[model samples]
Target: MMLLDLFAVIAAAVLSVRGAPALTQDPQAAERPTAGVFVATDLNWGGDTLWIPDASNGSCIVLPAPFYQGTSSFGPDKGIACSLWYHDDCDSRNPSFGPLRTPGVSTQADWSNATYNPNSIDNNGIAPNSWDKQVTAFNCWNVGEDGLHID
Candidate 1:
């Protein structure tokens, strides 16, 4: 029927829109120019992007299956970085999730001060010897005023 054809067309359009780079933003962070986190599926900031809308206030986040170890970038600050761990270290926040590995961290592979911009502190997560394909759970915090990285 003609109605069925119209429904199919509408559905196709909606699906196409979903494929675009969607910014699932949080209104609180939207006010700040540099607030959320950007995790990409490939190095050099290429490929699919997973945006964490609330990286400024400190919290633990477990990367969904699509973004595991893909690589990450913080808000527009060279000093801002996320503490990345190889296994699921967010047990309290994510009680149901199991560790992807043995639930530990390799300092060489897990970068605590991981920034997209390569710096002297080994901040780059996408580097050859960094957390490129190994990150699972990460802790994000405000730039300063922090006793702990994640809360």
Candidate 2:
């Protein structure tokens, strides 16, 4: 996203939270900001949706309450991406959702390659290991290629 566009989104979000009307000539033309992960309460992408802003670099941010215990579905929007962990502090271990690459390594799938099916993800072959509705924490960063591994 462009600097001006990002600034506009931040300003608008602040205004909206402060109960101030947004500054726009046409209310219908103002697009909702799409610079973060979109988490839904219902499976198949339904029910309440929350837009979580990008986490500062290398920061281990915990998921918000209610969602901290479980999340039905989640997808990252353009410009920003992240990975979820079954435990707080971004630790993907046994019984935790992880990236699908190595045969049995605990890593999270990249945002661009997310399948959006927590249940299908390989956490293990058991209960909490199924990865369905089992997210406790996460890490996020702006999607960029420079100095970043695509895998």
Which RMSD values do the candidates have, in order?
10.9, 11.0
Alpha-carbon runs more than 4 Å astray in model 1? 1-34, 72-80, 90-130, 144-151
lDDT of each: 0.46, 0.49
Q: What is the clash count of model 2?
A: 4
Candidate 2: tens digits of C-alpha lDDT, residues 48-124: 44556544254677777656755666654444456667657565443334332211111233223343334434554
Model 1: lDDT equals 0.46
Question: Highest TM-score among the candidates is held by which one?
Answer: 2
lDDT of 1 by residue, 1-151 (tens): 9999999899889656544243333212333455555665554344565556565454667777567755543222222345555556643322121121111222333334333333223322344345445667766554433333333
Of candidate 2, the 10-residue stretch with the lowest lDDT total is 99-108
Candidate 1: residue 50 Cα off by (Å): 1.6
Q: What C-alpha lDDT, on a 0 to 100 scale, does residue 6 get in candidate 1?
A: 100
